[model samples]
Target chain A: MSASLRKFIITRILLTIPMVLILITLVFIIMRILPGDPIRSQLGPRVTEAQADVLRERLGLNRPLIVQYGDFLVEMITFDFGNALTQGERPIKDELAEKLPATIELSIPAVIFMAVLGVWSGAYAAKNRKKPVDYIFRLLSIAVYSIPIFVMGLLFQILFSVRLPVFPLAGRMDTVMLVSFDSPTNFYVIDAIITGNWPALGSALAHLALPAFTLGLALTGVFVRLTRVNMIEMLQSDFITAGRARGIPERRLVYKHALRNTFIPILTLIGLQFAALMAGAVLTETTFSWPGIGRYLVERIELRDYTAVQSTIGVFAMFVAGISLIMDILYAFIDPRIRY
Target chain B: MNDTSPLVQIRDLSVTYKTRLGDTSAVDKVSFDIRHGEILGLVGESGCGKSTLGKALLRMIMPPGRISAGQILFNGEDILTFDDKRLRDYRGRQASMIFQDPMTSLNPVQTVEQHLVEAIQVHEAQTQTPDATGRIKTLLERLGIMQSRLASYPHQLSGGMRQRVMIGLGLVLNAGLIIADEATTSLDVIVEAKLVDQLREIRDEFGVSILAITHNIALVAEMADRVAVMYAGNLVELGEVSRIFDRPLHPYTQGLLASVPTTEINERKELYKMPGEPPNLARPPSGCRFHPRCPAAMSICSRHRPGLNEAAPGHWVHCWLYQDHPEKEEKTLKVAA
Candidate 1:
């Protein structure tokens, strides 16, 4: 690599430091300012007001606001998230370490599905532009993009699980199989495969199918439209016309020349969409009752678990910033016009 | 030179654009020939259908623009009858096209080496050319491009270099003919002149014919052996470059020549401007397409469209002024002398 490119990457990395800091500080403040007392919400009517006060004092909620804010920021830097108020005071870090991988496992496959299907259908639509095939693909993309994620998830469950019985309805694995399978990665599918647990793998994948599809299908529309519109524009470009004039076959012109040029914009969209998918996973996890960070976040938020919420939001912000940085580096590699 | 058979013959060709508003006649009943190993310059103002005519020769007209009527004969075979496969083979091997803007004519993501190699490999899949790299090196060298620039992307190259690469792409298949549709229009004056000189060298070295299309008459004078002037989708005059420049028969041609400033005449003569804009092709003027703009317009010019008449030994003009009239013939002879 050239010195300039290395410098560009280092600059981008340095820039992310301030971005992450701002994001963590904002989430910290937002969690604290929101109305609701964690002890009251967790204990509900079962605990008396005096007992709740005692609990709040023990949890450092009785401290001055500045002191609590400082403590929160310091704990974040050290990756310590204290404990969940509702889950028997289980350490938030341990819950996240166990659940984050499950979210990733589902998201990774959904993204793969979204990228592959979206790009393929998009290219097909562009090549057949102005024809019936193009119209059908375009309408289908619009339909998928407009549908609500949870609604789509529920629909899939009804069709594929309850009525057809082709797949399981909810959760990460069957109850009987869950006990026998040793989770090495906390990601049931990966752990199942690593331990030679084919039955567990089958069960985990069966349960994963509907929700992943729901998430993947919801995001596929954007990629399809992005690729198709960009591809059509690329096909009309002087280079593509020149390629055709050179007697390069139509397929090669569309795929090799037009598609390659269209990728930079598509890649930018994918990066933005990946961040969106991470957020959308919250609703998807809730619908399927899958044990992932998004579902865990919802549970913590309902119980006003401020520490857990702050940490989760911080982790999400970091993921988004990191992905965007990697995308910038990739842009430089793919298109030579971009430089430091 | 006159004895050589024409390589491509266009007979009464017409290309029309079927827009929703109306059908616009871009190339109306045009006829000409590009003979073997000769450069035929097609010169006209913008939107005069010169580029459409060039594209018509290769049957490369896309939607909204179609060759509504015409026959393009290549070696006695009408290319209009060719299928997709035959047209594909004919395009890069028999003839190819170079566009105007070199900056946008090349894929920004592809290197020059890849562009040239793809052009070659697309046509000759089972080639026995053992040294493909060497072949590309020679091709680039012939176009005055450096070997090191082969790995560079289009954005990395200068405009002149990119145009040279475009020229290299045109000649990579050893095509017999190249249609340069305003290829040098986007270059600076010096770069344009250099490219024209290189085109002349390529013609002589490779023995390939060219159809150089442009609105720049000066460019045609420098690069073309023969020139055809088009106005409002009509071929106004066709002749040897010297005759067309010296003794233009059509009034529109005369007007075009007068409008150009020449350094030879040191007396600062006012540049003559053609009085009217080009007629819209959707509803062109009656009789002669140039009649409304013709300086020497007459009643006959508006009533009858004159066919091409041979006024001098290899010079053809479509004008009523050249028709057989004793007095008019004497007047034309005096003008020619």
Candidate 2:
């Protein structure tokens, strides 16, 4: 590596610190300002005011605002998001560790599907611009983009589940097959494959298919449009013309020469969309009854679990920040034009 | 030099661009031949279709720009008839082009090594030579580019170095002919000189034919053995460089020569400027496209389009001034009647 690249990496990493801080701080402030009483909401109206006060004291909610804020920062720094206020004081860390990977499992396949299908169709459309096939793809992408994810999920459920009876309608796996595999990573699909539990793997994938497809299809339009536009621009570039003059095959010219140049912008979009996917997962997960962090977040928000909400949003902010950093590093690796 | 059998023969070639407005004849019935082991400098003002003609030789014209009528015979085979596969094989192996802008011509994401290796591997995929790197090293060295620059991306190199790399790419296949379309137009004076010297050396050393397209007459005078002057999509003059410089037959050629600022004249003389812009190709002038702007235009010049006729030994011009016409008076009387 060059000195400039080293400097660039250092700068990107340093910039993330303030970005992550601001995100978490905003979440902290928003949780406080929102109309909610975690202790009362959890204890119910029948509980005595005295009992509520004792519960608040135990959970550090009785402390002064400054002391609580400082403690929250310190605990966050230490990666110890203390017990949930609504879930019988279960540690938020443990809950997240169990749920986050399930969310990732859903997101990974969805993102892969989005990228592959999106880029392929986009390139095809660009290559066949002004043709009937291109027109059809354009219209379909627009339709997919306009529809809401939950609506699409519900519709897909009806068409592929109720009507055709092909896939499981909801949840992470069949209840009967859930205990058959050892989930070493808490990501049932990978764990199922690792333990040679093919039935569990099939069950997990079948349950995941509709929701992931719904999420993937929802975001696929953006990639398709982005890649199509970028690919067209790159194909018109002089380098692509030069590549053609060099006798490179048309396919290689499109994919390697034109598409490779389009990657930096496409990668940027993917990074942003990945963050958006995590946010969208809330709707998808809720609709499907999938036991993921998104569903956990919605449940906590409903029950007025302030600490759980804060910790979950904090984790999301960190994930987004980390992804942006990784993308920056990747840009440096792929295009030598970028430097510190 | 095998002058009898020209390496590439372009016969009555015309290229038209299908714009929304209408069809514009960018290149109109242009014909010329490039001899083996010789430099043919194609000089004209911008938009004279010189660059289009160069691209036409390789059939590299992009869409909306089509060869409406032409026969580009490369070694007796009409290249215009070639399909995509054959065209791909023909380009970069038998002939290659060097673009004018080095900055935009090279892929920013690709290293110099990647560009050179791809140029080689695309044509010679069946060849099992691990010495691809060795060949690239020698080619760059010959072009005055250092071996260390191979790993560097195009953005890392200077403009002149990049131009050299472009030339290196053109030469990597050991092609029989190279069409340099204003290849040195973007370089500085000194860099241009160096590159022109390198082109000459490559021609002499490798016996590669070159068709240098440019607007610079002085560079052509220095480098090209023969020159073809184009005007408004027509080949106005073709002759030995020395003869064309000494006794220019066409009025446009004379104007071009007189307009060039030479150090021989110590006193400052007013630069001779051509009066009008090139005619729109959609509706070109009635006869000679240059007649409207020509200093020596005649009534017949507007009515009759002059064909390229030999004015001297191995010299051709498309102007009526050189034609002996006994029928001129009779034709004029007939037009009046």
User: Pick by DockQ: which candidate is best?
Assistant: 1
Superposed by TM-score, candidate 1 places the C-alpha of residue A299 at a distance from the truth, in angstroms, of: 0.9
Predictions in order: lDDT: 0.87, 0.88
The clash count for each model shown is: 0, 0
Q: Give candidate 1 regions above 4 Å deviation.
A: B1-3, B128-130, B324-337
**What DockQ class does candidate 2 belong to?**
medium
Q: List the pairs of residues colliding in candidate 2.
A: none
Interface RMSD in Å per candidate, to 1 decimal?
Answer: 0.9, 0.8
DockQ of each: 0.78, 0.74
Off by over 4 Å in 2: A1-10, A45-58, B1-3, B325-337
Top lDDT model: 2
| Model 1, docking class | medium
lDDT of 1 at B13: 99
Q: Write the per-residue lDDT of candidate 1 for residues B1-337, one digit (tens) a residue.
A: 3337788899999999997769999999999889888899999999999999999988889988899998998877899999988888888888889999999999998899888888888888875444566788988888889989989999999888898898888888888789999899899999889989999999998888999999999999999999999998999899999999988888888888888887967786688888889988998899888988776676767777888889999999998887853323233322211
